[model samples]
Target chain A: MTRDAALLLPSTEPVTLIDPDGHPVPHVGHDLPDPQALVRAYAALISARRFNDQANALVRQGRLAVYPSSHGQEACQIACVQVLDDGDWLFPTYRDSAAIVARGVDPVQALTLLRGDWHSGYDPHATKVAPQATPLATHLLHAVGVAHAARLRGEPTVVMAVCGDGATSEGDFHEALNFAAVFRTPVVFFIQNNEYAISVPLARQTAAPSLAHKGIGYGVPGERVDGNDVAALLKVLGAAVARARAGEGPQLIEAHTYRVQAHTNADDPGRYRSADEVTPWLARDPIMRLETYLRGRGLLDDQDVRGYAEQAEQAAGRMRAGLGEETSADYRDLFTHVYAEPTPQLREQQALVADELSREEER
Target chain B: MSAEKLTMATALNRAMRDAMHADPTVVVFGEDVGPLGGVFRVTDGLTAEFGEQRCFDTPLAESGILGMAIGMAMNGMRPVVEMQFDAFAYPAFEQLVSHAAKMRNRTRGRVEVPLVIRVPYAGGIGGVEHHCDSSEAYYAHTPGLHVIAPSDPADAYGLLRKAIESADPVVFLEPKKLYFSRSEADLTAPVPPIGRAVVRRPGTDATLIAYGPAVPVALEAAEAAAQEGRSLQVVDLRSIVPFDDETVCAAVRSTGRAVVVAEAAGFASVSSEVVARVTERCFHSLHAPIRRVTGFDIPYPPPKLEHVHLPSVDRILDAVDELQWEYA
Candidate 1:
């Protein structure tokens, strides 16, 4: 049932496995992930940061319509994705492109929605990931549904639904948690508490002691972790995944991190926050902290760090090249896939558009 | 096939039974749908026959229920979800409009949400406020959804089965008032394909286009008009989204006059669409402007004033009288 009272009690301090200076801190009741897994996580974190930077650059170059950068929250994204099996599904929000990429999606494919594509770039069924939902908290319900159906069919699949702190305030969020708790679905809700929801700070979002505590009201276990600490995130998210797979019901995780960049290229963070407020979060960057820990463990040398950087650079170059290729838009896509079989009305509309296009070409 | 006199409610129940028996992936869920067998008893005995896994009750959250149905549908399951009342479905509008309806197109055919949302709609059973709203137009205006409503037992059984078997999401609106109406029909009859209209009565004088709850009223008006020596044809536009424009326009073109009938509000209603399409296609053939007999444009009034607010037999007759019969 519920965890021990000590574990359930709300704490202002996040559950962390590594301090800001890159030293490993012992967790009382949790076991750190293997050193090899931690090292692999460090690489993925580096890759995510590089990918975010490339996407942001594309927006400035007029290649991408916009981008939501997970600049400082890579650990939350990569660590949570690392623990999922091939059969498990990941329901990601628009801001969770890093998680989507970490789940084996191509960088260009994951940015399809932000690129103004008609639909998701990749096949969700093939990748075992749902489309990146733009509307807030709606994917949580879908995640619960998929997990519930999997349980009904006796499948050993779990679901990881990722959302932001602001999304927790939506009615769908409340409904999702309540339904998941009632049905005991194998779902883990990962909320990245990145301090501000497009400039609205957490203090204005809710009066609750912590975002994770919201799960307790629905009877689901809640956990908090320093999002920038890859080791702690891996430990907490891995445990949550295990609990769900064991049919122990859903769990909520609040990853305490900061959004180092603006919400999007179109957003101006200076409108609501000052430089002083952002300076502190930059000091606790997830990548630098993990690099320090790996160096301390003698698991990473200067050459190894350079190799990871090169790998990230190569991936970013490939992404940039892929996005630079232009593809013409098919106007017929407007009518296609509205239904499995296009209705007579849609067929008529398609013909009208075709006629208009042909007339324009003749003119 | 054996034939028996069955009520619309029973026909719907048998349809669900057949769908679940034929397809293991088909699941039925909603509030009070399990042990209670639904408030109107339409889902009676389903849980007992199919087991709780296939048939179960859900919490009173409409958004959650529909949201889960979308997820289930996306993942190799056919989920038939019930919205206890028509107005109660408002809470799930975001999920329906933003996700379930758009999933197929949004995923570029890679994903299909084969979901059937069943809502008991319209007035006449003395229900008040949220229980009696006619909100079909709201769904019809949405681009990626298929909207259908049935007026009789046979269509209720057949259309509901077709909806569950469809590859896209369908908004299946059941006429709550006609749930208990009885008809002699064979449950195993070959159902008609969706998105086609059926001419219930054939006549050359004029066309009365109606669907759902207003079909019976339109038929009554046709009967009274026949006695008055004004022959009237009755057309039931069963599927509203992919409306049967050919059938409707053909009838209206021949008669040179038309009257569209519905229980929903008159402004921007399905009836309005029907009238506009007919007028566009049959401008030269029409001897008179097409008229519409629909509920007044206002919130569904209290039960006592429902008869006045809703389109009645008199209203249909009045619409028919407004047509230029002398010119015809």
Candidate 2:
């Protein structure tokens, strides 16, 4: 075994390609993504910011049960989707609504779980994205397994499993990384370190220098990046994805960012944090930072920004219309899909439910 | 039929061998399952026969093994994962309950986790705690999972093969105590599909419903009752979740009395479900209330005191004796 920890350790400082003021920074460790890709990422970030706002509004209107807003972490969400190929899979967490939407899933369908209509709104096989896991860190193992299976089948598929800093504390997280490294599976573990897991802070979550550093013991290389910087995220995550796809092994990436909104609409951030902490992240907003950088480079102009805004509004309008419609769930659906073929007990229960429905209808 | 005296361990090995040979998608992995051939050797020679890709050993993490199995299943491979022992699988309960059991339903049939978790369970192996436990009730209580426990060599081979072929996830409970139990198994015989109870020994006075490790004890009790001039039927329930109520109730209705037996604890157990179902369907034809012969509702005891805790032949006979034979 190679005793060298240099290859496995993350950079001393998180890699950043663009500063908070939107100026390009010199980073010898990593290179920036292409200008076109950065512009596309900027477009996604704008749409995602609007998507988070629209979802939060829907929650208030009682159209959605709850929404975990990825308001400031749009760069990580968009980069997670943009860095992957069509054949690759993405295992997203419950808070990754933005990533799911970025992957081309219908916006309304992406909110189905929040709308309380279904467990998962879209088909996983069709989207190549596993259903957003509510339970923490469990899906990471699934991502590793999918990557391992792809390798076994001689398929060129790299799986990107994304979770929050809070999930890094879970045992499944350790198991997933260890399994991936041991098997040399094509998986890139992306951690959107949004500082807190609900009320818990990063300090309380782990004593490790960084979440990425935890991967060194497992022999999986780690990389830390500025999650708010799209250029940096694209470059770092893209390199990790390419490395994994090239049969180098799994990689762990911890993206340092902040969750500007509460953990969910139900949560009160005031109970744990102050406005002073929230005010700083507002100025460091991912969309504005990327817009500034792209504008300086002349890749994006005023007309282009207006066009992106109109597109975002149209997308949000479509989501509003789709979510406003009534959802009629068939009572019989409860008994279906539990198995390939319903068991005798399920059939009996189905009959009971049908009888109850008929009796209610008669009354 | 070839007269080959086979053990349950060997039968299970042959089942995996056959299934792997038939389907290239089938892969088997678990701790100590590769070159070690597993502690019980149920996976003996699998590695030699199918290479590391098909038959392998995984890290000693139950959740990881099970979670990976679900992923492999989703990606078009049939993973037959082992939990090493019954109690050891507790760590993966979340994976089993949340994902393996709910994936298909959660995805609205868009995805199916066609994986089998083989857990060697029940006491009588003189093993320490965590090595021996009848954990079938935990899996049986979960929906969208087929909980199967075979009592003999033939059933073990057949059920495991059927489990691998199932489109839905299956929790296969292998009784460690009976791993070496020998029988003249006809491997070529077409085994019955899941969700069917077999009348191991048909009788009339009372129905003895048992499964897994409890079957032999119930059968011996039936034999003992025969010497005492009492007819006791033995019913081995192969599958728990998709329970064979038709077969079990039919036997109970014929006997007019039922005695449910299992090595697991009595309260809210598989045996309790059996008693309730039999009582529900055979209530009118019953002469006496159904009785349950099960392990105590306490933590499993040490090996020295396990006999007193586990359901035995005497306990089944006692339950049968308590079935109000006065009416007959």
Candidate 3:
């Protein structure tokens, strides 16, 4: 049966449980999350923000190659990992380092690809996270496939595929959502529309009403939430995940947010837009907004806020020390995993490299 | 043992059926793969036997099909996906190269994409554009992929079975021209190891090397040469990526002359790689400069002109005659 397009459409206005001033905003369908989960999300946001700052410092210190800072989108990042079970999978893009770390991956291991040591520093299977895909929207299809496979095997595993606003312009995005809806795969495509794909604005990226609205065409219901409001994100994402887990098919969630920082340390945002534009987003800072809500409810006191800050500082220090330890790469690593068993040609090439390295040492 | 005469399509169908019976985790899917069977009927009756859960049809999106296959494979399911045609697989090339080929290596062996991408390729049925591209080189050049092509019915069943059981991703290229080619063989025959070349015919003169659709052309050329009192040997290359260097080099060394043939463009192709490798390994034993008979370095022509563009028996013999026969 064909699904009603109107029924699948997102709310014209982005859903908000808490206003930018950190005051609760009651809505018809959504409600505030449990105070415990809100506190956990707050703590993770602090750590994620701290990690982003430290990753920038590492880049300046010559310890890391580069990092795509999720400086302003912490609510969306934490909510993605927080909603999934340990048995579920997370397919993240390179810009999703914040979520990767929030998923309990070691900060240093999570930065492996950005560090230039390997494509992925940590074992993906151990954490049930895919490697941080550098190509835009390419891993979305993989997420759909995993969800479909889980359904086939009678496993109740849900998958979350996270991509940026720019990724919505990619063809794989359409294909992934269409396949997920057709197969009724238990997956959520979480699109963090932070208003830019590098320098291109959301206005130039699409003519659609919203990224979430793009899902309705594929039979996947769409939802939009206030990205700065942690209470709202937790509520919407949690509900979407539950629907998927209950075999209601895939869901698409577009978090309306902003990228306060430049695309990366190398980018100069000053060239693309004026400081006047960032001033508005700073007022709607996800961390500050969430902190105010927690404080107002007495769920988080000054002591708890200070404790989370200290905990984030400790994590940053540990990551800094770990990354500071310089290590040489093993040449054999290049050929070792190209195949489960190295082919003869690869073996011969490995030997050639080894022979050349020894000759250079002799010289 | 009773030998059953089977077409290459039927053999492939049986291989998939047997694989599905043996492993519950193995699945078959692609466009038109279920209910209607594949366009070539390669997956004929699979959905009926295994049910739609095991055998299914996907949307008409090549990248989606391959991308989903990679994900399924990562999750411990051996997925066999079919690209409706050779050219149709181009849209999925990024997924194949970026994810499927590098999934294991990039993840440092933590993930394995055990998938079989079945692409029916090559021109002999006078197929129009997009249907007759011999795209083996694109896959063969990729580091982590295994490129296999079967020349006959037996190898179609045998090699596809091997590809399904493989621990890594395999690009199984089926020669569209040979789909209905008949051969009598035992279905339970133990197949030769992958990446090993098989000597189809023995001779003392120049060796004719080929794979896929070109293999039959080379054999026909060799027979034509034999009638002219020129004993030309024929060697079928079953695998293109982990090239059978030993078997190929040995044949070139014994014959002291060689000719490579393939349906893809000669420049920077699998045929070019074969010539370069044989020349490097058997330079001392060469009685003549190695030659190659390949499709012209242009887009596959219209159905009427394909006969001229594709490597034919005449083209193979011409390449053989150019192997310094006077010096021999």
Task: State the displacement of the C-alpha of residue A71, model 1, in Å, after optimal TM-score superposition.
Answer: 0.4
Cα deviation in Å at residue A275, candidate 3?
A: 0.8
Cα deviation at B53, candidate 1, in Å, is: 0.8
Write candidate 2's Cα lDDT for B214-304 as tens digits.
Answer: 9999999999999999999999999997999899988988989888889999998898888888877778999999988899998888889
Candidate 2: the clashing residue pairs are: none
Q: Under CAPRI classification, how is model 3 graded?
A: high
Query: Model 3, range A42-76, lDDT digits (tens) per residue?
Result: 99999999999999899999899888889889888
Best candidate, DockQ-wise? 2
Clashes of 3: 0
Q: Which ten residues in a row have the lowest lDDT in candidate 1 chain A?
A: A3-12
Q: Give the number of the best model, judged by lDDT.
A: 2
Pairs with steric clashes in candidate 1: none
lDDT of 1 by residue, A187-246 (tens): 999999998889899999899999998887788878889999989989888989999999
lDDT string, candidate 3, B1-328, tens digits: 5579999999999999999999999999999999988999999999999999999999999999999999999888999999999999999999999999999889888999999999999888888788999899999989899999999999999899989999999999999999999989788889776788899999898899999999999999999999999998899999987789999998988899999988899999999899889988899999998899999999999999888888888878887878776775
User: Candidate 1 falls in which docking quality class?
Assistant: high
Order of the predicted models by lDDT, top scorer first = 2, 3, 1
Interface RMSD of each: 0.8, 0.6, 0.7
